[model samples]
Target chain A: MLKSNPGLALCILIAIGAICFALFSGDPYYVQVVIWVFANAALAVTLRFVLLIGELNIATAAFFGIGAYTTAVASTILGWPFFISLLAAPVIAGVISSLFGWITLRTKGPYFLLISFAFTEIVRLIYTKTEALGGNSGMIGMFPPMELDAYFPAIAISILAAILFGLYAAERSNLGRVFKAIKNNEDIPRSVGLNVIGLKILCLVIASTAVGLVGGVHAYTNSVIAPADFTYFVAVLALAYVKIGGEGHIVGPIIGATILTLAGQFLHSFGPYENIFYGAIIIGALLLVPGGIVGLGVRFKAGTLMGRAGR
Target chain B: MELQVQLLMNTLQIGSVYVLFALGLTLIFGVMKIVNFAHGTFFTAAALVVTSVMMWSVDTIGMPIWFSYLIAFVMALLVVCVIGFVVYFFGFKYVLKDLNGSFILSIGLLLLLNGTYLILYGGVPRSIPAVIPGNITILGASLTIQRLVLMIVAAIITLGLYILVHRTKLGLSLRAVAEDQEAAMLQGIPYRRVALYGFLIGATLAACAGALMATVTPVTTVIGDDFLVKAFIIIIIGGLGSVLGAILGGLLIALIESFGGYYFDPSTATLAMFVLVVILLIVRPQGILGHAEK
Candidate 1:
């Protein structure tokens, strides 16, 4: 498989390099940034995963929050072991997302979009209202065990990279083809005696579970999690990443996430102007480069090949 | 009895603004087939304009409060219309009937406009003096005269929209296009123009709500955003693109908020609304007045 797909091989090599850097680097700041890139790429990939079924799932943010909160509650409140607490994130997020998808998947297109948006907001409201979850101030103290302290960043990056690879693998499988068919027309898939809604729920569960794991890693990485952190805006940014990266393939979102996350570091000092910059970027990409950066690259390569043939 | 009357009055007051806001949202959705996530920005623009215009007219020019407010209200509507026209031409026109594209475009507009509002107006919440002061008692329920006027104006605007939609030639074209764009175009109706009109009318309704809301509450850069979530819920429950549904949904949500908030806490009331939405989705996913999806 690695011999056939050089792209996958390169990705694995990069992941190993990132993990090695995290393990060996003395500077924590750069390691944190690398972790953020992996985490955001996972988010963008998972978001695109659900788009396979033609629904804009804003609840991606909600499930991420759920994962974080589950880990937080398990570790801080229940005093579970580190690995178990982290494992609980995806489990809880997956279960809740299945239920959420069952109720919501019935509504397609704009209805699904609006309902998911509402779900994200309401989930955040629930977090704020529940005092045991730390309310508006949010929860803190999600540290890994001392022995794992230095290795936590490496571990987080590895898991996040694994999520990216796992999702990419799923996208290339038969299940992914079914999801594409559903997006093209659900009735066709249903006519085949397939459970259309069931597949949608599964798709949501897979993406949500991935994001949930990211959220769990995030909780430990940041050592704090807040209700404000999981707003519908999170999904919007993920969508931006998907758009900018070019959603034609899995690599687009990763590239988009890496560029934006790093740009975000520089934009931090600009105050409210940061939002304007992102807004401009989103609109510009939509109008000028609807295909995103990857799309542009594809067009360029195609043009050069055509020119050589013409000559 | 008095407490019930007070609650009823509160419901009507809140419901009126919601009806106007949701009507615009539904109307735009009906015509363009795109959700305008930046609809709240129209509301924000109007409220911000009202605040500035009121302050300039009253504080600087020393105009009388009521007259100054009338000018501010008109100015607010005008400014929102202009903004709507610019956005419709520059952005929304291209994304017509494209839901995801339009959603992203509107969000970009939301971030850009909101950021500009923050820079221009600062983060402080500003409130104007009540244009009409004093209180009145009706059925043993006391309400300020200003709030009473706000409700009256909102009701008048809502009724005017109802008449325009039902009785006018323009309204006929709007309904025609919304019902079936291709069929309407076959009938020689200009789909794009009608869509522009529908979008402007929707923005104006939001402007009306924002202008009225500024009279009662502090106008912040983000005041309009507070209504966005609830307005979405109202539109969803009422059914997308249904004017009457928006009206009914708005009133129904306000009724729930008023009574539920009174009975339980405000957060519980919000949770109750979400629960109600889930139940509604299970029963009638198309909404109470919405047509079944194709």
Candidate 2:
């Protein structure tokens, strides 16, 4: 069925899953877990947008933090409406992404990775060191600025769906094709008079904006924010979602986020040992199935599952 | 003038330890082209190893502090050497041919190592007793003997590394493999062994650094993250894949951070170093001494 009409099948499957999740959203724990998954999915998908362009950004969490803090400060400090504050999240993220992207995206590989990685540190440091930002204690007592609670899962689902669909739309658009072309060979387009840097910055804006929006939602959902929440671990974990879910398609983040988020719950009882479990799974996944669970499914579909699991 | 001397001493002490850590990283990266994200974990693990060994010997066996430190130092090296060997075999061997693959796998190694450390040690903080206590006042500035020794140790190691890389068979094999892996293989250079040797030596050096730093500061699992980032900035500004580059880079960063912290907020000291790296990359992404990619 997947091969027969992959797009149609995916749409139908998600519709059914979203409906079931929405029905169960009445439970606070269920809704919270679902929100966590959505927030992470948004982040992983945003990360995917750049990963599509063959750039690895480990700073999506920083942008996510930007959105969260912006929302927190706007709502609590300035008495802004949730809608207005939320809008500022992505706008702020886009502006920063463009500025930083222009400067850092000039380099690639480790250079690109390091600069992007530093972004999280800078943001975290600013938030931690600046007393106005609440420093290490962070800000709390947040609620969704609008009647988002009445809609609950509808709002959450819509946000997650919008990011996924936005990504889906991009995959089908000329921009996506250009992204692919750029990713495959930046020089090929450079010879053809394309503005490579502009496109790359565009990629950053879109990805950071999506992640930033989720950050606002994340703050709204949690009602508390801390610098510790947006660390190097979160960024790396988002990359894991993309890698293990399947980077080639939009479904990868969905699958990867769902499994890992659920797995996190399963291991919660283990306390500190939970990280050990997560680490082991990621290491095993990288060594044994670097292509991720989706790739494994694809391999199984074609009957080449044997002798190729260790790639 | 007193403050200036003290700050310079502080810079040298920190910079020396950083050189120890950064050189190991540059060595592995130079030969393998794999960024070991978990490079910091080795430092932490070695500290843990040294701390536990020293505590056990001093508390249980009633050994002297100096003798216990000696035992801890050798044991830490052995433990970290094993960790490096395991890392190379489990992480590097599989992704040897793929740069992107190694990068992703290294993150996994990092998470795995971090999680493992958390499980074993919990979040408790411990400190390694100073192996060489007491201070030597030099020109109206008092500095710990341990720190001054570390500076000299760093200088000696730098000279030793230069000699080893230039004058030894193992270094010849490593240089040959690094220069041209395919060509080296054709010439029957056991590049895999060279990689293993490099990783072990690098790990041993990192252990030395961890042991040294732990004496002066507290040993916490997360301490590695800060040092690792500094090492990264050092290699980035100094240029990756060169020993001399790491030394020079380490000192430059240490000085910037020391001065920056003294003049500004101490918490933003790393921010200063990070900003310097960004500006450096914008002007010269290949780093100060790194060869430009063809």
Candidate 3:
């Protein structure tokens, strides 16, 4: 079934390995890493969804926060079931980002970036200060639908797998082409009589919703949610995933996030020095592999990469 | 009434350092077309330099206060300029034409610089003693003499920068480069020299602000985070590439932050600024002094 695409095959094998590891692997640490990889993979793809339309969104944490918080509130405050809250999280996030997109997407580039930056801080402060949202105490005692230790991670990967498949389908569709057109030249899309704003909002909404769903998965996996979890640094780190993975390809973000997440595992003991390593990874990717790891793969295929065997 | 006067002084005291940063940030953007995320780190790093210099001079070398300050200021300027040039060479040169690449590169630079700073300085907030230890009371409001001196120094630098950008031959070349890189390059202006000088001068101004700030505020590795965000808002509201807009934007932010913080909570102050920037985006995307549409 996966013979036609090697990339799809790799994803399948990885998903299988993840499930097997979660089910049978003795080490909880590696299982957690697998789950973290999946969570970031979903985020990286969501970010790529927006980037596909040429928008430099630094607001991943904001929408993610919205998703996580909404789920927490729905589950705890409103006494909704985990399943319903999980579904509602992305919807709430999508609606919120729609409002944001309506206002801020009017501006482009750095202005868009700044507005997104502001949104994260604003959301964080509101959550931090608002008593209704538990203020600084945040929401705790989240029970996943399943009680098993591995259940949340399994569900998280399943959610991510679904998103990956959905994104894969979208990448081949006409809608993706419109996003690319907008990315390449907004004026061209406008000249073709496409509603540029509408298309952008579409991409933003889709990306926001997907990211929100991941945020829901995140809250359940950790069994607690806090405003601190979705800070600007986390958002920037998400952006770095897509950047270090590669641009202009679907698999780049997955590769980037997986590599970086695993690297984080090793660098965990580095403590304060971990950030320096992250910075070094990003800089190295930009300088040496502007195409990211996938780009390097593409180059090797094209026989342009030094000391690498070409197909 | 006393509160108002103190707030006014407070506005200028913070606004002066903010203006120094915003002006340098805008000038660098004008020349390089890349927003330096590490710009605030530059400010903090330079402040650290100034703080260390003063401590060494006053305690270790036992120099007179004025002489120590003089040495600190000059050395900080030289050191920061070199740092700026090195960043330009290593961090920025390859990605000069690629806006996104350069922006990400600078983001990496921010993390790298801030991390190095944290490890080196150990997260302890430090402050140099006031350049002059006297408080002047005006209208029943007491204000530190250091802040007053800082305002004057800020004025001198602003005036000097205004002269440098508007009057001198080098200024002409720099502005020409900003106007049109290719045309200026074709017109016999050395691109690297103009860019390097503009960047160095901007970095030096930040160094001056950092040094001056050492006398007023505690210096920490993470202190730059707030200023960097403020600089972005200032330049955006002031419009990118306009020094006057940076000045205006700086004052507007300082006022907003001060008045808003007083009237509301810290979150409200920041929240208000965020709202204003959003509204400005809809109404006047070019900013008050920026050219139409970035």
Candidate 4:
């Protein structure tokens, strides 16, 4: 029943549409936007993976920054190829995440969150203040991929969609069942003799690697890597995207990124009003639709349509 | 010796401001699990209120400096408290019912309040005219009377808060609610009312700090972001809910920034403080004052 679901059909349609939109837009400016949306979506999905285990790591931005800078510095200074730098980016980020998780995994809830945030701030501060790197003036003149001639946006979106679906499928598989069990009752997962710490750390590494990939692409696409781009606000925005779109499923990040990007474009001229709009949407969603749009759809079907059909 | 004295004074002044701000944040966090991202927005709002009032008094009405400061403080406090109450009722009610639910909602409120400030006030740093005219030398250290006044006011407020929390009936109720909300609700404490009071008190504290800070530093819409980070840092360092711990944490951060900046690069100093927070968490996650359960 699960293998032959209508949701899978919907997912495929959405993926195709997204890929088509990216390819056809043909605007250079829109290409940059696509890169940003995919990068953030990847990070949001990573956030979702951890959130499933009831944890919020506020350092996703820091890791993203780390990956971006690592790639930027390697390409700019060492004259490495884009693909090689991209490959190294996640390894660097994953190493940092592993060290951070080693220290912070024992602390629970808000304290854990605060410490992670501090870690992010430290990375940003180091990036900004180190004159040897760039100081407050920021890193400039990054190089983009040489191989890709056209349809970069489509490529990026397709890659991101592929990653999202990959993660979603993994979550639905037998391995995914372990993640659900861990989320349901952490102690029960432990009592069942599951390797909880190993599983969580593995998730963190995987998420960091995903973010690192996006960061590398972004660094190359933007031709710049500044400390300002990777602040606590970035992390919060990623979390917000996940929360507003829906935490329980992978499509939520896509929906969230799409909605926010569109909303941002429309309200771009309004300055802070855009944020107020974003915030209001978040608050309304949390209050009225805790399960998010997907959850709302489920409730509608179960409460009205399904009940009526039964009658 | 003179340089040492100057650094000490600067550290003390900045430390006091942070202590006041972080203490306010801790109070709310203690009672409500909500992070109150809007906590620092109140600081900015209060600063704006202080700035506008002081501007009107001096620039428009030509009032005395002393009177201007007093009026600014009161008006700012009143305005922020009202905002706090409104936030508690409108934004917080839903979030507080479910921890995860409110976190997202509060985040939205953070963006909204920040945007509101940006829209109302242009994104520029505006300073409050100093009330005291000149500096006075004390114990071989020259200090501005305005800085001294700020320190004194901060101390008095902190002490007043300490007494209020430990000695009063309302403070006791606040504590009860913080300890266990449902149990406190069972005692006919009216949890929502107490939560509102907590919000008001926290808002008032943060506002007062903002007003006081305006005298020392210029006010900008984005300044709240800096204060929010500092407050979150302090709350973590001092532990979540402990009053005494917040005071120590504030001072500790202040001293770290002061000495670290003096010894190393300013950026490195900031990074060090954050690194220390991570180290401290691994060593003792509960912080200087927080209990194990928290």
Question: Of the candidates shown, which would achieve the greatest DockQ relative to the real structure?
Answer: 1
**Candidate 4 error regions (>4 Å):** A1-3, A16-36, A141-145, A304-311, B97-99
lDDT of 1: 0.94
Chain A TM-scores, per candidate, are 0.97, 0.93, 0.93, 0.89
Residues A146-185, candidate 3: write the lDDT tens digits.
Answer: 5654566676787878887788778679999999989888
Docking quality tier of candidate 4?
Answer: medium
lDDT of each residue in A22-118, candidate 2, tens digit only: 7655677776787778777778888888887888888888898998898889888988887888788888888888888888888877767776777
Off by over 4 Å in 2: A1-9, A12-25, A307-310
Residue A273, candidate 3: how far off, in angstroms? 1.5
Q: Give the TM-scores of the predictions, in the order they appear.
A: 0.98, 0.95, 0.95, 0.93
RMSD values, in order shown? 2.2, 2.3, 2.4, 3.0
- For model 2, state the Cα shift of residue A100 in Å: 0.9
Over B1-294, each residue of candidate 3 has an lDDT whose tens digit, in order, gives 999888888888889889999899888888887777778877888888888899999999899888898898888788888888888887787776466787788888888888898998888999887678888998988987878999989989998998999999998998898888999999999987788888888888888888888778898987777787788888889988898899889988999888788978678888788888888888987788887763
Q: B1-294, model 2: which lDDT tens digit per residue?
A: 989998899888888888989998888887887777778888888888888898899889989998998889889988888888888887788777465667677777777787788778778888867788898999899998988887887778777887888899888888888777999999999888888888787777788888777777888877687787788888888887887899899998889878778988676788888788878878988889987864
Per-residue alpha-carbon lDDT of model 4 for B1-294, expressed as tens digits?
887887888789989989989888888877776667677788888989999899999999999988988999999999998888888777786666354565576678778888888888888888878898799997788999999999999999999999999999999998998889999989999988888788788889899889998888899986767877777888898988788899999988888888788988666667777878878877887887788853
Interface root-mean-square deviation (Å) of every model: 0.6, 1.7, 1.4, 1.6
Clashing pairs in 2: none
List the candidates ranked by lDDT, beginning with the highest: 1, 3, 2, 4
Q: For residues A141-213, what per-residue lDDT tens digits would candidate 4 score against the true structure?
A: 7655556746656776776777677778777787677877876777888998988877777777777777777
**Candidate 3 docking classification:** medium
TM-score (chain B only), all candidates:
0.99, 0.95, 0.96, 0.96
TM-score of chain A of 4: 0.89
